[model samples]
Target: MASVGFRGDLSQAFRARIPILYVESYEEHRALAEIAAVARDPELVRTPRALLTWSPTSGLIQPDGTARRGAIDPEDALVAALRTEEPSVFVFCDLHGTLGPAVVRLLRDVAVAFRAGPVPRTLIILAPALHIPHDLEKEVSILDFPLPAETEIRALLDRMIDDNVATGRITVTLTPGDRERFAKAALGLTLHEAENAFARAMVDDAVLAPADLAVVHEEKRQAVRKSGLLEFVEPHTGLADVGGLENLKRWLLRRDGTWLDEAAAWGLPAPRGVLITGVPGCGKSLTAKAVAAGWGLPLLRLDMGRVFSGLVGSSEQNMRTAIRAAEATSPCVLWVDEIEKGLAASGSGSGSGDNTGTGARVFGTFLTWLQEKTRPVFVMATANDIARLPAELLRKGRFDEIFFVDLPTGPERTAIWTVHLNRRLSRPAVAGRLDLTPALLTELTKLTDGFSGAEIEQAVVSALYDAFAQRRPLEREDLVRAVTNTVPLSVTQAERITAIRSWAADRAVAATAPEDWDMGTGNGRAVEF
Candidate 1:
C-alpha cells in the first residue's frame, strides 16, 4: 500500500474493472481528488468514468451539487449506484463505520454486478481506517494512500508564504536550505495539516524563521502520539553523551546527512539502521536515543509488546499501523528497544508459544518492513541477548550493520569514567576539592576494567552517596572503595558474556575501534572495517 505511483495503480484497477477498491487515508479530500483525477482522465483510465461521491450525510452526489434524491443513506446510495448505467467511479466515504449485514450483502452484490454489468464501473470505499467485512475480504483491494510527499508539502509551504508575504501579514526570512528543511520536516503531514502547521508558524510572530521548524515538528509529534502504536521520543542525549563506541559513533556521524536529498543525488541510500547488541548495562539503548538526537530527527519507539492484541488478527494490523506511522514521520529514527524479547519466539517455527502463530505473524510483518521499507526511517534496534533473536534478523540487508557492543574496553572505560565524572564533578558542590586529573581518570578506568558503562555510572553514584554520608569533599578513595565493593556483569555472567563475544567474533562488527580492542579483557574484536 505504498503511495509510489498509486495514481497509476488506481488507474490500472479502474481499467481492469477491479469492482471494489478500498483506500485507507485520513485526508479524505486528498484521496478523493486523486481518485477524481484518475477517473476523469481518458488517457490514464482508457475510458473516462464519471465521478460520484457518497457519504452518509450527503449520499451520492456529482461534482455539480447534484445529489440523488432519497439516497441519503448508505444502502440507498449503493442502490443508486447499481441502478446508474453510466461508467462511473462511485466513492463511498466513511461507509466502513456503518457496515451492517445488509450493507455488506448489498456491497457484495454491487461488486458482482459492477464486474458483469454492461458499462464498466468501480466502487471506491474511502475511510480513515480499514474495516472490510470478512466476506468482502477477497472482493476488496486495499490501496494505501500515503501522506503528502515532500514536493507537495513544499508547494503548500510556498503558496502559504507567498500569500502571507504578498498581503504583508508575515515576514519570511528563510533561505533555500531552510525552506527545504521545513518541507522535509513536514513530509509526513497531509497537505491540509502542513498548511495548518505553516499557517501557525507564520502567524505565531507574523515572521517565519528557521526556528519555526520546532512548531512544525510539534505538530508531527501530536499526529504521531495519536497513532498509539509509536511513541514520539523526545531526544535528551546525543552521541557525544555516549561514553565510548568510537567506531559506532564514527559510522553514525558519516551517515548523519545521508537522509538528505544531497546524499541521494550522490547515489547514497539513507542508512537502513544498525543493530547494537551485547553485554547488559552497556550503551545499546543509550546509543539508540543518541543517534536520533545527533541526527536531529524525530525518534519513534515501537513497543512490540503493545503491538500484540487479544484479538485474532489485530496484531498484524497493529504492526502495519506502527510501520505506517514510522514511515510517515520519516527521515526519522524508529527505535525498538530490547528487540530480542519481543521477537524471540519468531526464531523457531511459524507459530511459537501460546499465541497461536500470532507472534510469528507479527514478527514476519516487522521483518518484512525492515527489509523492504523505502522511507528514511532509520531503525535503531537494541538487544541484550542476541542469542534469542531469529537468524533471519541477523542476516545481511535486514540492518545496514550489526554492531556488537562489548563491555567497556580500557580506553572505552576511560572515556566512560570521564563522561560520568565530568557530568557530576562539574557541579561545585559535588566536586568539592576533588581534581579530575588524567592520573585520577586513569586510575578509576583501571579499577573498573571489566565494568559496563551502567556499572561505572552506578559506581560514581555510589561514591557520591558515600561522600554525602561523610559530609566531606569527594575523595578518590570513595570511588576506589565503590569499585572494590561492586561486581561487574563480566564476572557474574562470564559464561554468557563469553558466548556473546564468541558469536560476535565472526558474525558482527566490534563496536569498539580495532585500536581500542582490549585483548586482556577479551571484550572487543580487532576487526578491520
Candidate 2:
C-alpha cells in the first residue's frame, strides 16, 4: 500500500477489515518501512497496531528480531497471522511466488477471521508482482507501488551527502538546484535504486554535480531492461540532421522543455504529441528521433508487434506493462513507427470466426492509454497510410496535431541535397577535396523535383558510388546521371499519392509550406528527374 503512495488507504482497510491487501514493489526494505509507518498512524487507524513480517527464509519474525514459532511454508504463515490475537499488521513478503490452492484457502480463512474479529488484524502481501487466486480476488485489493517521489529522492540524496560529509572522505559540493536535478532524473526509480545511483555518481567524481545526472539515468535503464516491451533508443541525431519540414520542426521546437516546472508554473499542460502521416520516406521517422535529441530526453521506441500474445489475458497485460514502463520514464519521447500497421488489426470484427476478439481488445487498450494518459510521455506516432488508422484515432484530443509529410518540394529538396552532400564531403577522406558548392546542389535539386528526403539521400549515395567506381573526383554530371536513373515513389505510386494528397488536403496540416507542397508531383505535374 505504501510503495504506490497509498498509505492513507491503509487505515480504511484496517477499519473496514478488508481481508487482504497486496502491494507490488521491488524494494522490500523500503516497502517494509512504509508499512511500519502505517502501523503506527493513529489518524488512519483508530488504534496503533503492531507490525510483524514473514518471508520464506525469515519465516514468521517480529520487527525486533524475535522469531515466533511457525512453519516455514506459506500456508502456515497465514495461519500464524490468523491465530495471533493482537491488533497488528502482518506482512507476507515474496509470498506470491509460493501461492497455491492451499495458500489461497488459508488466506481466505484469515480474511474471514479479520472481518469478523473486533481486533483489527491485516494481512498485507508484498511482492514484486501481483498474483491472486480467483477465490480471493474479490476479497483482496491491490495497490500500486509508486516510484520514489521527487521530495523523497532528494531526501535520500541529502542523507547520503551528509553521511559522506560526516566521514570527511567524499566531497559534498552540490547546489540545491544540482540536488534537485539529480533527484528529478532519478524519478520513477525505487528508493533503493536512487541510493545506488547517487552512490555510483559520487564514486565517479567524488562529488555530486548536475553532470552526474547521467548516472541516475543509467539506473533508470534497469527498469527498461526488465521491461522487454519498450526499447530505449540512444538518441544521437538532432533536428540539424533532418532536412526541410520546417513547419513541423518549428511546432516541435516551440514545445521543447515544456514538461519542466517552469512550464507548469505558466499554467500550461505539456503538449500531448503529434501524428506524422504521409509519404513513407519523407522524414517521418527521422523527425521522431530528432525531437528526442532536440528536447534532451530519452527516446523509447515501442514495438507494437511484440505487444500481442496468444495466451488469454496476457496480451492485455503486456499493453499495461508497456504503458507503465513509458509512464515510469516520463519526460521522454515515445516513438511508435508505422503505427498504422500496428493497429490495423482493430477492424477485423468478423461475424464468422475471429477467435477471441483479441486484436480489437489490444487496439482498444492502446487507444485508451493514448486518450487518457496524464504522464509526460510524449508519443510520436508515424504512419504512411491514413486509411489503415482507425477513424476515431484521428479525431480531436487523440493527438495534438496530425501532420502530412509529402514528397520534398523544390526548395526542400535543395536543402535535403545540401545536408546530405555536405555530410558526405565533410568525411575525413573527402573534406575540402570535393568542390560541392551551392550551384551543384541547386542543379541536383532542380533535377529531382519528385524525390523524398530518403530518396534524395539515396541519390547522394548513388552519385558517390558512381564517382568512386570511376576512381575520380565527383562532378555534377555524376549526380545528374544518378537522378535520371532513379524513379521516386511519387512516380511509381502516382494514383496513391494523389489519393493521399486529396485526403490530407483538409484533414491534416501539411508538413510543408503551401508554396513548397505545390512544387512537387510526378503525375500530370512536371518532374525533371
Candidate 3:
C-alpha cells in the first residue's frame, strides 16, 4: 500500500520527465489542492513562481496570488510563465479535447524551450477523461485516483447523520451495526453521494433500519442508469419464492452467513459465485433474482448484447466502463441471463465481419475480473445450453460452483404450484375458485410434469382464460383441460431433455432431487425446456 502523504512520489515522477498524468479520481478537488501545496514548497521546485495554464480561462499564473480562475490565452500564458527561467510547473486542465495544431505547437515549443534551459520547468496536463494521442505518449505519465474507500464513505455518512440529527429535524439514531452496514453499502459511492444517500434515508424515515437501505440502493440504480452500460433490477423473489432447488438452496444458505459476520472473522473468503445451466424457464433466471434478495444485496443485470456497438472500439469500451461500474459498487450481485448466448464466440459467427474475437476477449476479461477482483461483487450467470458455452467458462475457479437446474421435482412442483396459486388467489375472482386446494395442487403437479415454472404460470393463465370465457368459476376441469392442451416441453424435447439430465447428473449439482426421474414405472422428472 502507498503510504499517506505520498505527494513526494508525484513530484519525483515529475522530475523523471514522465509528463502527462491520467488520474481517475473522485477527489479531483483534492488532487488540485495537493498540486498547489507541492508547488509552494521551495525544496520541491527551484523557484517560487510557476506557470499554470488551464482551459476556458486565462494562461499561467505566478505563485504569489490565489490561483486565478477563467484563464484566457492559455498557450501564450504558459509560454510567458515558462520564459522566467525559474523551475516552474505548467498545469493544463481539460486541455485534451482542445489539443489540436496550435495547442500541439505551443506544447512542443514549451517542452523544447524548457529542455534547453536549466530551470527544469515541467508541464502537467489534467483531464477527467483520458485521450492519449500517440504523438505525446512518451511525454506523459498516468496516475489513477480510485473511488473513496469504505472508511472514507463511513466518515462521510456519519457526519451527514450527525449534522441532520444535531438540527433536531431528524430523530433517527443509528445502531453500530446499522452504521457499518450503511457504510459498506456505500463503499463505491463518492463522499458527496454517500452523504446525500444518508440524508435521503434520514428524510424518508426517522428511525433508521436496514430496510432504509432501499433508499441508498436507489442511488446505485441512478448511477448505473446514467452510464447506459448496465441495468439495476429490483429483485422481488426470495429463497422460498424459488421452487425445487433444495440442494442449490442449501448451498446458498451455507454461504448466506459468509456475507455477514462469521465469514470474515473466520478468514473465509467470500464465496465466488454460481453458474446455472438448464432448460429455459426452469427458474434459472428466477434463482438469480432470488439469490440477490435472499442475500440482501443489490442486483445488477449485465446485458452483453447491449455492450456491442457499430463503432470499432465502442464494444470494448462499453464493457470496460460497465465492469468498472460493477466493481465500484462491490458486495453487490451481478446477474447475467442466458449467458451462453452472450459469451459464445459463435454468437456473431454469421460472418458479417464483426470480430468474433471480441466475444472471446470480452469473456476473458470478465473471467479475469471475476477471479481477481477483491471486491464483493458476486456474479450469477445463467445459461440454457451447456454445449454453446466455451470450455474456458466451465473450467474451475471462474465461478465457485456450477449447478444444473433440471426440471422441478414432485415436491418442488407442489411448492411452485402453491406459491403461484397463492399469488393468483390474492386476486378476488381467483381466490374464490372452487378447486383451489393443496390436494388440487398435488394433482396439478402430476399433470405439469416437464412443465417449467414459467410454463406452469402460463397454464394458470390458460385455466383462468377458460373460466373467464364461460363466465363461471375456475375448477379442476379447467386446470386439467389447460394442462392437456399445453403439450409440455417433456413430450416435444424428450430426447434432448434426457441427454441434458444424463450429462449433468455426474458433473453438476442438481438444483432439485434426482429421485423418480426415470421415464417409466409412473415416475416422471420435472424439467423445463
Tell me, by TM-score, which candidate is best. Answer: 2
**lDDT value, residue 247 of candidate 3:** 71
TM-score, per-candidate, Cα-based: 0.87, 0.88, 0.87
Indicate the TM-score of model 3: 0.87
Please list the residue runs of candidate 1 whose C-alpha ends up more than 4 Å from where it truly belongs after superposition: 1-4, 168-175, 204-211, 350-352, 409-414, 425-443, 464-481, 516-529
User: What's the C-alpha lDDT at position 27 in model 1?
Assistant: 92
lDDT of 3 by residue, 403-432 (tens): 988766676666667767777767777656
Please give, for residues 1-529, the per-residue lDDT of candidate 1 as tens digits. 2344789899989888899999998899888888988888888987889899999888889867798898998888899889989989999999999899889999999999999998989999999888988999999988878787788888888988998899999999999878988998898888888888998999899999988887888889999999999998888999987766778998999999798888899999989999988889988988999998887788889998889888889988999989988888888999999999889886674543554888888888888988998889999999988789999898888999998887766767777787788888887778877888989988987888788889999999999999999877788999999999998888999999989988888888878777756545323433332
Residues 1-529 of candidate 2 have per-residue lDDT tens digits of 2244467666667777786899888888877887787789897678889998889997888768787775577887787788888888999999988888899888888888998997888899999888887898888988766777778887888899999888875886677756666766677788888889899998996876666777777777787878999888877789866766767887899998687776789998888899998877988998999998787677889998788776788877888989899888886889999988777756564201246777777778888888998888899999898877778788788899998887766767777777788788777654434677777767887888788878888888888898788766666777788899999998999888888888888888877555434344311112111
In candidate 2, residue 159 scores what lDDT?
90
Q: After superposition, how far is residue 89 of candidate 2 from its true place, in Å?
A: 1.2
Off by over 4 Å in 2: 1-5, 158-181, 206-211, 347-355, 427-434, 463-478, 514-529
